[model samples]
Target: MRKVILLFAVSMALSAGVRSAEELSVDLMQSIEDTNKSLSSNIALSNKQAATADAKELTQMFAQVETFFDHKGDAKNAVDLARQSKELSTDIVGFVAVNNFESATTAATTLSRTCRTCHTFYKKE
Candidate 1:
């Protein structure tokens, strides 16, 4: 009876663990989707000959990403990457606002790199 109870307890714990992980993964994917939506919107605005609009969208997206990181738990590397990406996005927004396309492009490239790095590690197939 004791052995059966022990086994049942262990199984329950394992089930709960799996549920928690699944929840976390779902939340993370949602965060990524939100970030991607912002990026896409900004890119479209940029291509529409509206640099100011693009910069505003990018800034908002970066803010959402930061908020996502703030709510995350046990994702230290991801949080760090998000922070770095936010800085790059901020730089891009600033440069674009100033009509400095060259510098904005460079900052955007860096931001892309940060996204790729984070995805490669955290986004599993």
Candidate 2:
């Protein structure tokens, strides 16, 4: 309950700065990539605090992706993948909170794979 409220507060605060304009997908993707690396490293180190922070940020970023895909309305698969990524991010936060580094690592791996799968379909080569 406390974590959920904190997450909501953090998410709202983070998104507040960008109220002037929605982030371009490219910019958002770059942010996701950078945050993902931090998340993976922190999970490997069993740094719960850092991992949780990164995961929370990722969860928010993937939510943005989900909204982008849903609004585009051309790729249901992308929307699904985005949602899966978001859930995995949240899972990582929970796993790390409990000192379950192995499970957190697994969730992070799946999250990376999910992003790559979406890129295979949507990214221009």
Candidate 3:
């Protein structure tokens, strides 16, 4: 039946989209981890320029994550966590601009923890 074929096609498209999203999220996660480590090191060294750049990149990435969750429409807590992490990234940029590495470090730690919390709750199989 045409109805059955249409339903099957729609189901296939959705499954493919889910698979693609998972792959993209995995790549994004790896990049975030690398950037987070670089950010911590930059903060420790008091590298204002590098730290600012890292924080900005983190903010952008978290925004992407927030958008991803928002589109999925199933993970409210994940969306909130991503937003909180994005705010922390922005805070880190401000702290680095002021040469306040201590506060920036603290914010980075908080951001890392926020990421862990989200992963714990919303990790993909």
Q: Give me the candidate number with maximum TM-score.
A: 3
Superposed Cα deviation of residue 119, candidate 2 (Å) = 0.5
lDDT of 3 by residue, 18-109 (tens): 88775446778889999999999999999999999999999999999999888878789988999999999999999999889999999999
lDDT of 1 at 122: 74
lDDT of 1 by residue, 74-102 (tens): 67787788777767766766776666667
How close to the true structure is residue 105 of candidate 1, measured as C-alpha lDDT? 64
Best candidate per lDDT, number? 3
- The true-versus-predicted C-alpha distance at residue 82 of model 3, in Å, is 0.1
TM-score, cand. 2? 0.80
Q: Give the runs in model 3 whose Cα sits over 4 Å from its true position.
A: 1-14, 21-24
lDDT (Cα) of model 3: 0.91
Ranking by lDDT: 3, 2, 1
Give the alpha-carbon lDDT of every model. Answer: 0.64, 0.89, 0.91
Q: Count clashing residue pairs per candidate.
A: 0, 0, 0
Give, for candidate 2, the lowest lDDT window spanning 10 residues.
Answer: 17-26
lDDT of 2 at 123: 81
lDDT of 1 at 12: 100
